[model samples]
Target: MSRQSIVTAGVLDAALVLLFAAIGRLSHGETLAGLGVTAWPFLGGLIIGWLLLRAWRHPLSVVWTGLGIWIATVAGGLLLRLAGGQGVQLSFAIVTTIVLGIFLLGWRAIAALVRRTSRKRMPAPV
Candidate 1:
């Protein structure tokens, strides 16, 4: 809702993306350069997740945002594969995307819960 929230989400999303890519590369015995290719899906996930959250009005919107972004990333990778390319690594990419999405969205959810609890603890204006 606020600009700060949006910015925070973006930063978290990007960091998760990088983290996921690094882990993926390490797992596959590949170099960190794999991070470059992973960035596309990461960026896509970030944008999509942020936008969806921005428009979200329900308490569970964060969960939907995370799942949606994970789906989007996987779908993007699948499209790339279908387009006659070497394609992104399916296992690593999808797993990493899901994990990162959860982390990012989970952070938002926790923050929202904290804010809500705090508001409830405060006295209402007369």
Candidate 2:
């Protein structure tokens, strides 16, 4: 993959985490003052996953990087929230896992499909 694509993958992952945090905060009627706090757990988890995977080199790998980010984000987010005295509801956990999986994995899946289709459409060189 090109350097630009790798960077874009990382940015997309971060953006999705931020989006998830923002939506959750809004849903809970949280004031904007606490937005940073609300976003940090998941973000922290994402960072850890990136580090563990050394993801900067290959951020677009759906199996390694994407799955690692998803698992780390959810597990780390839950653990951190619990440590911070934020109760984790079964329903909330379920929603977070489902939504993050969709957001984190969805883009990569779409990109892969597009690349596959485009490759098929290209004519072979003589």
lDDT values of the candidates? 0.62, 0.86
RMSD of each: 3.7, 1.5
Q: How many Å off is the CA of 14 in candidate 2?
A: 0.8
Model 1 scores a TM of: 0.66
Tell me each candidate's TM-score.
Answer: 0.66, 0.89
Q: Write the per-residue lDDT of candidate 2 for residues 1-126, one digit (tens) a residue.
A: 788987888889889988988898888898667877877888888888888888887677678778888899899888888888888999999999999999988887888789899999999998
Candidate 1 residues lying further than 4 Å off, grouped into runs, are 48-60, 81-84, 87-94
Which candidate leads in lDDT?
A: 2
Q: Model 1, 11-107: lDDT tens per residue?
A: 6666766776677678779988657775665566456645655534332356666566556555654454346354556675557556766765677
Model 1 C-alpha lDDT versus the unseen true structure? 0.62
